[model samples]
Target: MDMDIQPPRRTFIRQMAASGALLGVAGLSGCTASGVAEEVAPGFRHGVASGDPLADRVILWTRVTPAHDGEGDVAVRWQLATDAAMRQVIAHGSVVTSAQRDYTVKVDAAGLLPGHVYYYQFAVDGGDKSVVGRTKTLARGDAKQVRLAVFSCSNYPAGYFNVYADAARQDNIDAALHIGDYIYEYESTGYACGQAEALGRVSEPRDVLLRLEDYRRRYAQYRADPDLQAVHAAMPFIAVWDDHEFADDTWRDGSVDHKTSQYGPFELRKHAALTAYHEWMPIRVPDASAPDKIYRSFDFGGIVSLHMLDTRLIGRDQQLMLSSYYDEHRRFDVEKYKHDVCSPRRQMMGHEQMAWLEEQVSRSTARWQMLGQQVLMARMEYPTAVVMGECSPTNYCALKKRAEADPSCVNEKEQRWLSAQTLPCYLDSWDGYQADREQVFAMMRKHRKNLVVLAGDTHNAWASDLRDAEGRQAGVEFATASVSSPGMEGGYPGRDPDDVAAMMVDLIEPLYYAQTSKRGYMIVTASHEQVRCDWRFVDTVFQHEFTAATERSLRVLPGPGNRRIEECYG
Candidate 1:
């Protein structure tokens, strides 16, 4: 467990109580998402938002709960301010939000100063306003410096998002490139979270999400997190989606989480997920990358070109399962060959996306070209050597997972009795899709050399020096770590996550520096010379007050072969 203590909803209520007293406002806990909870409408219910910044202007988004309550439209006035408070207004206007878009409103505030910070908020009923949101316009493409906070795979019920909270505190970051999985499809405690599921933090619907309402409830719950809210309030975010935002390891047609008719048809489920994802997230409509078109690009002062790729929708091949592994002992018959590494035309990013990615890489003139996308571009291999007596993430974590097999009778409450551990490899990630990995590496080599890959599907931190098609280190570097909704490798019961990660890294020989069973985020800094990355981990996430530190520091020098591990533990 990330923390022995579960999320303290009562603590939040208490904090609200104190803050409410300070502001002479009432703590409104009884309000529903459909209607206003209190007579007082103080600023942002969802908090401030800023995005899609050009040199002069940026996109602004907000929602207003109505007095006709959930059903009626609320005409809200928005104002951009130079000060943190709304005393000085730069641009002011009015927009109406109705039930059509779930009372959400988005407006692009253009014609502002370049490379400058601006504060904006919304006033509902032309009176009460939202929390001030701070945003910055980009410098010209040729500008000298820019930093990015890259992340993905954040499942709210998984744990406290100290990663997002920490990234919010980072220095000099221009924007955040969230490469998907902002929301997950699981409705209950679908995965092993760091805390007890009994916490109201349990994802709503109490099962796998299928209906639009289920998806919406999930988003509202995630957005209710104060840390995630603070990060969004603090900076402009650019995002794309990965599978869990729809379903675990999803593709155009289905997902790993998909079942038969009870969840509805796969297409309908996908449609519902995408519809809700588009509506709730601070993303633009008619995203070009659809089937669930969340992929897009962002240029940072033109010095660094961020090419966001959509790896899931158009070209995703079906995920590999345990069936892909057959015993080499020839002890089993033909049915044993089911999991025989299905490389038969499987893809992580389909052909069209591959071509699009290649074009973007080739066209970039920036000093650093970052492939900001979901999933790792590297082909991680399985650990052929399994220590006979040990099991990791534990059979307990994996056992409880309906993923490979059903939960055994092992009681997690009896965790103290276990001794030693074993490690089995996950068949997801790049390790599951070898052919797709080869194609992407080929593109990186052919189109560009100064490339760095950022990923967040797996939860533990990794630093890999990617090799070219010829097995020569391609000067391309991959920095991927664990999830917002973490997958295995977090170690459980008898396994110390660090020791288990140690055995796996040794067997697979991935170019990883530090892997922790901890929670936190990555911070990236790019100059013309080098791109520096820090894997920051929090001491504990479920606790409100936790210390964060650098678990590892790595660097990819510009024009590279492999990223050099620099000041690893510093």
Candidate 2:
């Protein structure tokens, strides 16, 4: 299959104006033929979208400009049809993309049947219309089969979205799970990408995006990429934004280093980011005005009940104070905040989400229950030795972040995790927030569902058997990995550094298998007997060429715990 982007369609504005029934923002150009509620041509910056599949309904979305209000609240019409050509309109509706939602449109096209594909599109006067969108509904429990393309961490500037392009080309997939990091927050660092980089891809939006316009521009750049567009066109997506959806490591109160007052109320930007995210992707919003609450669940006909969790919004805490947590001993400063767990009051998922998750996990009856989440859920116990020994957590460690060969490299003097010698580890993640993580695990215990988590954020691929607090494996396994942004191995001038990724995994504890140098998406196939995931990679990415290939991999419980590597597949 070809992965190529054809030239843009000629501007169809004139014909659009003559479509005879232009239902534009104002109706047509606000600059009327002769005054009279002059019709303003609707804008079409953001592309079309359709999501939230129930047995009988789906939500369709779009945004309109009044040929004015760079961000307008123009009125427009939306239609969902049974045919791709819109020759037979089934359900239709209208919405105003007013200044309120940055002029975006979202409407739930309900009362449809299950296990069927549908065509949808939006239009305005002057004949302007969005590209046709295709969507499908979830099959009921007894439906034969369902497939999903799992993904996360798409840093546009880091490399080409060729993995997405490749995944889109595959056949028989039911839907795509956009785990998060859908867009990077970084602006261009002219020197940070391209040939000298790990991935041979460069970001077009190479600048920090903060305002409504900046954000809009970035999405346009990403959506324009052929590979990304192909994936969206290929399947309906179930998406939930991670912190990058707003700002890196962002939480309810603040960000890692973001100035509080400079960016307006975190809530305002959060709402804007949510709006733009929903507008540009093939997903729906719960409501137009308060779309920040886009988290929801969907079942693909009983084979699996997929719960998409929101790890950033609602109740997340600003990332742990890493600096304060760092002790002069060059170790995790356990004494710095003795017994002070980042308050349970300090949450990752808000109260509403926590309760909702428990309810969903409690009620799910699918033979295999899947949680599409962000962040590492398993307890990662790296020997204090790894970070303190040959491994340095920083690109250049000042003692720690400095180069490995510097004459003053103190880490080299330390011994590995041998008898009397032990590695000092850090305290963050589920380890740091054991109480909260326990709640999730406890919920899993209460339910009989066989759980599997698909995650992203840390630009590394990992496979592990997840256990609840009591040490009983939740019968859940996680297939989480690195960014489409950059590789975990960083810049190591080498032919190919497979050993680096392997070494890091070997050094870190509780990890069954991993690959940090490669970049790609996973294809998961499950049946009553086993759930299989293939980690496919693109050999090259920087130069807009697709050479993605799956070198090797691992798997987890086949309807039961103790994961074993499939020697043949391995």
Candidate 3:
């Protein structure tokens, strides 16, 4: 057995207690007790996970609970086998985990064949074994097809992770792609926690996550969920962090929700958050010194080149709020807003990352170029009236009825409002950084690659045409709904969800499909000829017993002749 050692456990425990984390652990049911009782013993309670798979290697991860308070580093043994029964052991190793890494064990199990399935598990030196986990390696050369399960925005207190459970049962999926927001940073009574008390899904710590221990405990709570664990155990995950992983609307310097007076320093909080994220997630860090540089590419056996990007924290400028452009009279200055938004100095993916992406896209020889990213990249422009809250669905319907009844009854202001000029609804998306978006479009057009953008921050399902500023179609975008977060229906209190969705599609030109109220995920299938995306939704996340159904299916063909999205028919 191989043993890896760290600093003294007593010193680490004292530091953790000083941070108030040790005191809060007792109230959190998700956290396992350190003291060994008669009924319970120290074991692998958080389950196993695998991620960031390459052609020859995959990351295996698990956590070991301490049997007693004074325990030092724990030695864990892991095995990788070709079969589930562990008869054909191909790789085995031992590693030591201590409080320094939150007792989480992560090993890069290499020496595996390309596109092969492997089962892995971990056990303490003399303890019981953990549940078996299955993972697959990326294909190296030619491949017929590739399928990926796309997910985002999984808030623990909002509801159960039924979307993950449903995706776990999918046998054909090669890997799982989590675009962002794998965990929320809110307290027990924050965003989308109205039903948390009734569902008994209160967040651990019961306070907002600001320290390293707080973030680690939150991840532990999420990993403890059977549904989340099942999905992680079923397939290797390729993930990136969004704003919620740190704080709401996090940028480079700070977050919108963070106050330096209360949190001490934003940098300290961010470092703590990143440290916990690295320790908890099964990701291969790009750079040990610079952890924020997470943008990288993965080639899927020449079929698809998946480029996972970091758009939130890397090179993003402070988001431009549309409300800031309003006057004292509550009138919006469309021209001034447009001029400021189109400034060429603004950036979304920063200079270094953008240059890297351009080089990668230009040189890739794969059949499909898929961008796995966070915000909506397509044009989601809505009418000015609709965006400014001047016109709701109910109001629009009533005005239409009145206009049909008597043409003269409708006034000029109403007509102008109805035909209001269109603008981007959320400035935090690519819409705010128009110059950067144009640069990307120019690169795609120059390369003439088969582009497919996968986005998932809105918590609502969307399918849109990727077009340039001049209205030339570049590709297509498939934005998945959140795994558990509420959608647009939550904003519009009384309007029907279907009506809101229909209204959005009618107003937004590039939008082809929309599901305003549903908790679901997307299954993207890529081939040489075409790429298809199926939006699958669960009936309810309030209960464990739920049924899933395909809400919509859309496909985009390769080449210039078919850059637009069309209904996928049998």
Candidate 4:
């Protein structure tokens, strides 16, 4: 793959203009050329996007790259219309952009009506207009159905963003939830193989992103993708970062992948990545001083209220490692392990965020309390006996070797259960934070909230019951599969994903559905009565053209007694 930072090919405007043909707004008229509508040209190559929608407003975004390199601080004008023709002008404004902010422009278009679709566009004084983007504000009152296209972990080098393309084509999706790893920091040749060349895709810099410019260029490359742009142009995106936006397995202050000798100060690198992330992603922060403030809430009328959490950076304690348990004696003490895991000092969302979350659940009047977060909240513990007794010797040996390398692979209970053996419990996820997980479940139990968790980062579909300390059903979690990243099946070659899923279901009492062999996103439809989540998988990512199929659908009725999840459709 080439290391060159390719210029935006103006593909979004050229290709989407045909599909998103606009006549003008309903009542207001935009600037015209000789009393005629001019075609969008290559000026705003990165296209246009809208996100972080509120009841009466939305954040509009665009990047203005001057045809010449030295032309800085280009003046760009924008407008919002009630219709596609640019007739019903709702709002209009102008913003200046320069290389300082990577020429990206964002405006919070406020005072618009609630639960209404709006069309928006951007253009320079004499340059071509940008591709018209469609966005919708959140429904305020008496809302019926709300559809959200949920996606995450889209690795540029891994494969095509066919899931995003599929999402762009969906008419029912009112908004989208991008719950982390929107852009991976890995170099082009580092993460996955074959797909890059197969799809002519390569990440910029050709090395791990560590500097501010590195992160900026990477975002430009990702946003340049037509599919991603189309999805953003189609609907507003509620996004939150998980790990990869900065570095792999990032916490509050550091990342496991970062080395001072290689990446300078971790704080500097993290700040750079975050600055670029906020600039590129169409997100709004209440306080710029708090750089890692993506944790926010959104209300979808009375149907659901989404609490987007920053599980990677905000208030997360250092992740526990299983390797700490192994010693020269090779003796594992179960009591010591339990004491360490259940300690009150360890935290996931931190004390403040957890308190805020509980408050959100307690105060919300919405029928469903939706938590849009990164990493799976459901307990996905490995059943060592299943692998040791049923799996092939090769698979068992492989897993055992992996466990030896990372002791955090297994939890205290799983470690005890597999005393002499290994029962890996993907420690990077919520499974590793058992005490904190229990705290969250306790909050749900206290509030009697009809909680529905939306998670990513695992690159696999999981539908499970969230149980409280007393083994009572507290809520239900729907962990959406990744947009492109590989899953456990990819790590364990030759192992059957379905077989592993079946074993997990048998061992993990709360789990009802699981799939690891496919790559796609989830479509969540919420109403006052119930919320339906459909796990849809892309047929193939190696090719440009692909199809999507629903792997499964789980429906949860609000104000539930036990928060039961019924498998509805596929």
Candidate 5:
């Protein structure tokens, strides 16, 4: 591994600990041994959360903020109960959290029955107790259904997190699958964040986040939202991060948005962002040997198996920039573009991860295979006419300006090609990694798998057929709209979102449905027979009212019975 990208274990661990991961359970060992623990701070204010549910284990988390600022460490006690009233304490423990770990406490409560519901709470010694949170463990054997409330791209300053509130109220959600872009890195400015002023939402710090404190403060601000807190308190979440968690369009080594000269060292900044992510999230630390091992598999009995992939940070290469390509060639070279850009050497999931994914798929005994990841998987080709017709003049003007800024687009051949077609793919998405996409499809075919891909980061709802080069259907994808971030409709100001959605579906053969302007999440139900997804949209996020509608319901049955997704009305 690149030391710049991934540091050594002991060094990295110590760095994180000093930065905030300095959590020591030994500090509370005396109180626990004596059976008398004391809480040093106020009660939980960030709310309680649970995640990474296994057959017999689940990780529980909560933060203990003192009544006064600048307090040091707090020893908080937590208890898990079978009943909501906390009278039936099944599992309990005391942990030490200091200013280093940002006063957050996490406990992995094991030795629980599978598919069982448990309630938990944290209390300060001689102080107050947190609100009880309900969590469920993953089923052990054959589960009738695995319901996942899928969410992503929740920009704190863009609007309200009404979708999170709505998901909290939902009774059937087994686990919340957050496919990244959990928090944005941009500041609360017009040029950086699009809708902060328009939505009347202000992110804390009021500027770009650079230091660890800034990232922690941002997490605090977001978690402070009642809707977001409600969702965390209600259900366990399986999350994977996307680009905005660190910076815009980030990859393994660097980011398009960051300049080392201005931002200091890239490695330091990345380490800070990742450390905060680990501290705030209710996730288990990956293997110390690997370090960057967020990509893991979860078995939901024999019915479904979820493969939560890390598509952004772990191994992704830098995105292909069309301007850069054009500038290099001094004109549009179709053959060169296809050769260089579509080469098999270009990888999305690095070699080790790819092998691991393939091995996991082959070893999976579940009836349905689900890939919970970021970005769209389906092929999206853009012809210039369709782009011109659907997109606003401002969009064309931006493109025109970009072309003007590049030396290649000034030439006649490049200009002609630009007039004829806008590059047929979004370089930031899976469309840019055709060779990798083909490899995945080949793996799917070889394993004869029944796949259901869960995607986010586009900030728009999409239902597409995952087809191979021969147009053979490999799986079905349900890409969710954002929890609050702006979508395709927001990108194209004057055009109707509905019309844009319709146009996209029309333009892309595999894409069957699209909802470009809604802000909400997806509810996916998986069973032995089929995996169904309900694309739900909230009426608005600027208010507290939970007004929602099922935008569409799409389902795909496994195996030879069904290969394509069908609209499920009932």
Candidate 6:
């Protein structure tokens, strides 16, 4: 396979525009009849978006670029209507945006009817208008059904955002749920940039993001993506940030990717990232004083209570690394590693967030308790050798065959390797914080809630049965795949993705389904009876032309004792 070949930027953009993607700035520009360059007008070039919806309101956002640099603050007007033509306006407002806000405007339009759709648009004093945006308010009394389009790990330079585009065209989707990794902070040459240059998808600024302006520029670049703009324009988004939004493997105070010696201080970087995030995303700040506190709950009538959590930034302790448990002889101390990982002092969500979650869950009378979080909360334990990548799928199959053929043929060392104790593969997930996970399970069990967890960040689709340390069923988790980032297939070169996925399911007891190599999203539907998740995959992200299909569907029924995933029938 030729890895370097990719479609040209102009051709890609043209095809995307034809296929319903928003036109790139270059595509939107043109010359006059006399051949003189025509100046682009000042308007809402970044497109309009709405998010963080409530029963009575939704946040609307847009960015107005001045015709020239150094222009003073720009006055913008906004209107919300029940019709697309903006003739029957229900709410209208005006705001002033300056360079301090990066020329971005956000408005929380209130006085909306519950479970209703509204059309919104922004304009300048001279009558320049933005693309009309569509958003829906949450249901207030009785929502028999609510559907959400879930997405994550959208690396702009990796490939086209066909997943977002496909979801934009779908019907009956109440809103979009961006669990995390909304914008990656890597440089153009970092991570999954193998074909970025060929596809004309290079990251702007050409460097790793650090300061306020750097983060803002990255957000601008991503929002300018036609597919991304189309999705934001089509539906409201409920978002929370994962590690890549700030830095990879981010904790409360620092990250593995950050170097204080070079980047100065992690605190300043975090502040800048958060500032840019708040400015660009249409999210309602949970607290005006503490911008970092973004963990909040949303109720859909009496059917579901969706709790979006902040597992990366606010209260997470440093993640545990297995390499740190190596002894003098280069032997791993598994017992010690387990003990440290099970320590009660280790926190994933701090005391304050946990208390708040308990209160929300306890007070809600909804039929379903859905946690829209960033990381997996299920037990994904594999054999130590497999977790450490010492045993490939092919190798494991061969060993199993030999062991079944003759017991005496396998040596003691091989037996130990084959029957190795199981452990979590990624310490960055909830598996690393067993004590904290158990605390959450205890709270859910106490409230007798029918838990359905929606998670992303693995860049792979997964369905797992969540279990507590006591081996009791806790809930079911549906983890969506990445929008473009590579999955487990990237880690194992030349291996079949299907084989890898099968091996994972065979080794991990809690994992019911897994797709290791795919770029896609999931649609989670909640009702009074059950919650169903359908994983949808795009055929290709390397090109604008593509097809989307439902790869898998599973559901969990509302129960007093049972809370496990089962195949969705009919």
Residues 1-570, candidate 5: write the lDDT tens digits: 001111222332233235332222332232221112245447565677899999899999988766555676788999999876678999999998887988888899999999998888898876677767789999978589999999999988778887886677677678999999898888767322555667656666677778898888878767666567767877898998898888888998989989899988877878888878888899887675654678988999888889999888888888887665455546655566667557888888888889999999999989988899998888876655343254443444445566878855565644653567444458778888878888988898899889888999888999999987677888989999999888877567888777778767755668889999889899999888788888888878766554677768889988855768897856
Overall lDDT per candidate, in order of appearance: 0.64, 0.62, 0.85, 0.78, 0.78, 0.87
Considering only N, C-alpha and C atoms within 3 Å, which residue pairs clash in candidate 3? Answer: none
Error of 6 at 423 (Å): 1.3
Task: State which candidate, 1 or 3, has the greater lDDT.
Answer: 3
Tens digit of per-residue lDDT, candidate 6, span 102-122 = 889999999899999998889
Candidate 6 clashes between residue pairs 3 or more apart in a chain or in different chains: none
Off by over 4 Å in 6: 1-39, 388-390, 397-411
Per-model TM-score on C-alpha atoms: 0.81, 0.79, 0.91, 0.87, 0.86, 0.93
| RMSD (CA, angstroms), candidate 1 | 8.5
Better of 2 and 5 by TM-score: 5
lDDT of 3 by residue, 1-570 (tens): 111122122332234335432222232343442212223455766778899999999999988766664468988999999876667999999999998888889999998999999888888866667777889999987678999999999998899998987887775688999999999999888999999989878888789999998998888888777678777878899999999999998887888999999988989988998998888889999888999888989899998999999999989998988889989999888898988778899999999999999999999999888999999999888777777887875677667668879979989988987666778858888999899988988898999888899999999999999999899998999999999999898788897888889877777789999998999999999988889999989888999878788778899999889878998878
TM-score for model 6?
Answer: 0.93
For every model shown, the clashing-pair count is: 26, 44, 0, 14, 2, 0
- Candidate 5 versus truth, CA RMSD in Å, comes to 10.9
**Angstrom error at residue 130, model 6:** 0.3
Total backbone collisions, model 3: 0
**1-570 in candidate 2: lDDT tens per residue?**
222242222222123224422232333224221111123455453455566677887767665645554444466888877776578988887776676655567777788889888877778866878756677888887777677777888876666676876775676777778788887766567423554245433444446667666676667556545466445645677888887777877777666645657766666666667667866665765556766666678887777788887777666665555456666776665444434453555566778888988887778777677788777776665544444444453222233323345544444343222222222233334455556777876676667557777777777677766765456776544454443667655665563566666555555445567777777777776665556777767765566555655554544444444433342242
Cα misplacement distance, residue 215 of candidate 3 (Å): 0.2
Task: Supply candidate 3's per-residue lDDT for 69.
Answer: 48
lDDT of 4 by residue, 335-439 (tens): 565566667887788888888888888888888889999988876655555433445434544555566889888666445544643343567788767788898
